[model samples]
Target: MNSTRMRITTIAKKELVEFVRDWRTIVAILVIPVLMFPLLFILFPLLLEAEAQELDELIVDVELQADDLPDGFQSALEYSSINLTFAELDAVENLTEPGTAMEKLRSGEVDAVVRVRANNSTWQYAVLHMSTSEQSNEARSRVLLNLGEWEQNETRNRLVAVDLDPDATLNPLQWNGSIAQGDVASKGEQAGLALSLFIPLVLAVWTFSSAIQPSIDMTAGERERGTLEALLGLPCTRAELLFGKWLAVATITAAGVLLQIAGLTFAIGYLATSDIISAPTMTLGVVALLCVAVLLFAITVVAFELALAMRAHSVKEAGSVLGPAVLLILFPALFTQVINLDGIELFWFAIPVVNVLLALRELLLNRVVPVHVLVWMVSSAVYATLAALYAARQFNREDIVTTLS
Candidate 1:
C-alpha cells in the first residue's frame, strides 16, 4: 500500500512539473475560460443593447373619411410609440396613384405607409407596407390595436342605430382567481434551467481538452521519448505504474474541470448582476451537482483518452484519434435542447454524459428528479472505473506497447 502511494505521488509530481513548465498548457487550462466568460456573458449583451437603442422613427400616412374619428383610435397608435402623419385625399391620390409613397417606404425614406381608403366608415380597412419583414410585423401590431378601436366604435354605432341600450347585457358568470406568488428561489430556479442548458456541453469540452494533452504525453509521448521502456524495466510492477499514471491523469483532468467550473460560475454571476444575462445565482446544491457531474466526466475522459493514447504512435496521432471524442460531447448538449426533460425515459438516465447533464439541469431548475438519476450517476462512475481497468490491461500488453514503439 505504501509503495503504491509513493509511486502515485512521484507520478503526480512529475505530471505537475510537466504541466506547469508548459506555458501553452497552463494558459489553456486557466486563461481561456476566464477570458471567454466575460466576452460571452458581458460584452455580447452590451452590444445587443446598443443596437436596440437605435430606433428608427416610423412615418405613417393615415386617411380617415369621417371629419372626426374617435380619439381612442389615435391614442392606441400613440401609446405604441408610432409617429403618425395624416395625409389629405389629394396627397393620398398623388402618393398611391404614382406609387411614390410605396417607393419611398421601400427606399428607406419612410418607415411605414398606412393607407385608409376614402370609403372609411367605422368598418374601414387600413393597408400598411414596409420594406422589411420586421418593420412590417411591428407596424401590423400597432395597426391591429387601432383596428380594434375601430371595431369597438362600429359596434357602438350599430347599438345606437338599432335603438338597443348598451347596458342591457348583464354578466352572470365571473372569474375571480388570484395568482399564487412565487419566491425568489423558485423564480431563480426557473431562470437557472434556461441558463444551465449549455453547462453540460461546456463541462464536456473542458474535460476532453484537459484530459487530451496529459493522456497523449503520458502514453505516446512517453513511448516516443523511450521513457516507457525505461519505466517498464524498473522494479515497480506494471499494475502499480498503470495505477499511478491513471491517478495522476485523473487528478490533472479533474483540476482543469474545477477551474472551468469556478471561472464559469463567477462569469455567469457577474454577467447576471450586470444584467448582461438572466442567469440565477449559483447555490450550494447547484455547485455540488456540477462538481459531481464534472468528476464523472473527468474519469470517463481520462480513461478514454488514455486508451486512445496507448494505441497511437505519436502525440499528433493521439490527437487525431481523440478529436472526434470532443465533438461527441456536443451530442449531449444538442440532445438536451431537442429532448424535453419532461419526456425523458428512465433508461436515458443510464447514459453517462447525458444523465449528468439531465440531472444537473433538473437541479438548476429546482425540479424534483427521480431516484433513478442518482442510481445512474453511480452506475456511470462504476462504468468509468471499469473502463480505466480495461485501459490498464491494454497498457500491460507487450505487443501493443511494442507496436507503438
Candidate 2:
C-alpha cells in the first residue's frame, strides 16, 4: 500500500482494537447481527401464529336472534369457538331495532350478536360486534364462518328439494391457482423479493448503528480526552488525519455489517424453502448486487455520521444528534414497502435514503436496468464525496481545542 493508504490502515487498526475491547460494543457489533435475524423472522412469526391459533380456539359468547330460520341452517353454525345463547323474543326485537345492540356489545353483555330475519322470500343475516374488542372480533369471525357454511348447505338443500343432484346442480364454477411467470427464468428473483422486503431497512438501520460509536468516539471522544489535540500536532496534514479517522470508522461499520449479513445469511439458510421463503434464491449476480448496494449505502452513511460527530464536543452530544437520524431510514423503508413499484417515478432515484431503498428492492427483484444502477452509483458516490469533504474540512478549524472552527 502507498503511504496514504498505510496511514489510514494504522489508524483503522487502532480504532478497531479499542472498539472490540468493549464487551457491550462487541455484542452490538457482533452478537446482535447473528441473533437478530432469527428472532425477527422466526420467533416473531411463531408468536403471531400462536396468537392467531389461540384466537381461533377461544370460546366467545354470542347471542343469536332468529325469526324465520332456514331449514337445518342452525345445525351448521358449529365451525367456530363460540358459545351460543338463544336470545329471548324481547331481546331479539331490541337487537334488531338498531342502536341498542351496539350499546350491549360495548358494555360486554355479549361478545357478538347474530340476527337472521326474512327479507321477502330469502333470509338476511347480520353479525354485530365491537371492532375494538379482540373477543368481539373473534366472535364475529366465528359467526361469519358459520354463516358461510350454512349458505352453502342451504343452496345444496334447495337443489335437493327440487329432486336434482345437489353436487352437480348447485356448483358450476371450476377454479385452480398457479404462478404466472411468462417464461422459465431463475426463481432466484422471487426469493430475493422476500429477502429484499427487510434487507434495505436492515442496511440503513444497522449501518447507522455500526457507524455511531466509532465515528463519535474517534472525533468527540478523542477531543474530550485531550488526545485529539496532541495527535493534531503530528507531522500529518489535516486531510490525512481526517481521512485516517474516516477510514477507521468506515472499516468498523463495514465489519459490523458483514457480521450482521453473515447472521442474516444463516437465518435465511435455515429458512430456505420453508413457508417463510417458498422460493429460495442465490446467484453470483444477486451476491454482486447486494455487495454493491451495501458498500454504496455504507459510504454515504459513514461520511454523514463522521461529519456530524466531528462537530460535537462530547460523545453524548454526537449520539443525541445522530439518534433520531435512524428514523430518516425507518419511515421511508416502511413507506416503500407498501408502495407499488410499477408506478415509481424515475425522479425517485434523486432522493437519498429512498433512492437506496428503491434501488435495493428493484435490484433484488431482478428488475435491474443498467441506467438505474448507474444512477444509484453516481448519486451515491457524489453524496459520499461531498459528505467526506465536509467532514475533512472540520479538522481545518480549531476543532482540536474547541467544538467549532
Candidate 3:
C-alpha cells in the first residue's frame, strides 16, 4: 500500500512539474479566469449604468400647438426629469403633408408629438407619437407617467364632486408586503438570488475551459510526443498513472476555479461598494458547498476530458473533440437558467453536469435541501469514479499504449 501510494505521489509530482513548466497552461489557468470574472460581473454592469445615466440626461423635443394645450399641462411636464422642449406644431417644415406631426417625429427633429383633442362632450383624449429609439422610449415613459398621474388626480377630483371617496373606489384592495415580519433575506442572500441564474453557467464554462487544455496536453499531447509509452513502461500501474494525471488536471482546474471565485467575490465587493448591488452573504456553509461542487465538477470534467483525449491521435484532434464537449456541458446550465428551477424533475439530479449546476444554484439561493445535495454529490462521485476508471482502463490497453506512430 505504501509503495503504491509513493508511486502515485511520484507520478503526480512529475505531472504537476510538467504542467507548471508549460507557460501556456499557466497563463490559460491564471489569466483567463481572472479577466473573465471582472469583465462579466464588474465591468458589464458599470458600462450599463453609465449608458443608463446618459439616457437619463437626454433632452426630449416635443411638438404641440399652443392653442391645443390644456390648462396646467405645461406645469405637469415640469415635474418630470426628462427635458421636454415644446415647439409649435406648424413649425414642421412639411406643412402640406397630411401627417406633418409624424413627419417631424420620423425626421428626428422631435423626440415625440403630443396632441390633445376634445369631442363635443367633456371627454378629451391625448395621443403620444414617438419612434422606438432609446431616447424616444425614455421620453414616452416620462410622458406616460405624468399623464397617468394627471388622469388619477382628475378621477379623484371627479369622484369628490360626486361625494365619493377616491381611495375607496380607486384602491378597493390594499395589502402590505413584508418578509414574514422577522425573517428577512440578508444582502448577501438577495445578491445570491440575483446571481443564482448566471453564476452556474459561468462556473460550468470556467471549470470546463480550465480543465480541457491541461487534460488534453497531459493525455493526447504525451501520446503525440511519443512519451506516453515510455511512462507506461514505468513500474507504476496504469491506475496510478491515470490517477496522477487526473489529479494534476483536477488540481490545476480547481486552482483556476478558486482564483475565479476570488476574482468574482472581489468584483461583487467592488460593485457593492457603489451601493448598486448587495454583497453576497458567503457563509462558511455556502463556501463549503461551493468548494465541494467545484472540486467534484473539476474531477468529473478532467476524468471525462482525459478519457476523450486518450482516444485522440493528436492534441489537435483532442481539441476538436473537447471544444464541442465544453459547449455541450455549458448549454445545459444555460438552459437551466431560462427554465423554472422549481419545475425541474428529480431525475435531473442524476444528469452529470446538470446536477452540479442545480445544486450550486440552490446553494447560492440559500434554499438547498440536504437530500438534494447528497444526491448530487453521490451521483457526481459515481460518474467521476466511473470516468476515472475508464481512463485507467484505456491506459492499460495494448492498442492504446502501443499506438505510438
How accurate locally, in lDDT, is each candidate? 0.67, 0.77, 0.78
Candidate 1 regions exceeding 4 Å error are: 55-185, 224-227, 271-290, 337-344, 365-370, 399-405
**Winner by lDDT:** 3
Worst 10 residues of 1 by lDDT: 59-68
Q: Identify the runs in model 3 with alpha carbons over 4 angstroms from their true place.
A: 1-7, 21-24, 65-67, 78-98, 120-132, 176-188, 271-286, 335-346, 367-370, 401-404
Per-residue lDDT over 1-405 for candidate 3, one digit per residue giving the tens place of the 0 to 100 score: 699888878877888898889888788897778877788877898899899998877777655443455556667677546456665454433333336666766777766666554445343444455557776667777777787787777788879999999998989997667644555777777888888878898889988988888888888899999998888778888888888888788888888888888888888888888876787666788778877887888887888889899888889999999999978787898877775567567777778888889888888887767778888899989988888787777777777656675
- Candidate 1 achieves a global lDDT of 0.67
Clashing pairs for model 1 are: none
Please report how far candidate 3 places residue 130 from its true position, in Å.
Answer: 5.8
Which 10 consecutive positions of candidate 3 have the poorest summed lDDT? 89-98
lDDT of 2 by residue, 361-387 (tens): 887776766777777778877878887
- The TM-score between candidate 3 and the true structure equals 0.82
| Alpha-carbon RMSD, candidate 1 | 5.7
Better of 2 and 3 by lDDT: 3
Poorly placed runs, candidate 2 (over 4 Å): 1-3, 91-109, 159-173, 176-187, 279-282, 331-347, 403-405
* Worst-scoring 10-residue span by lDDT in model 2: 88-97
How does candidate 3 score on lDDT? 0.78
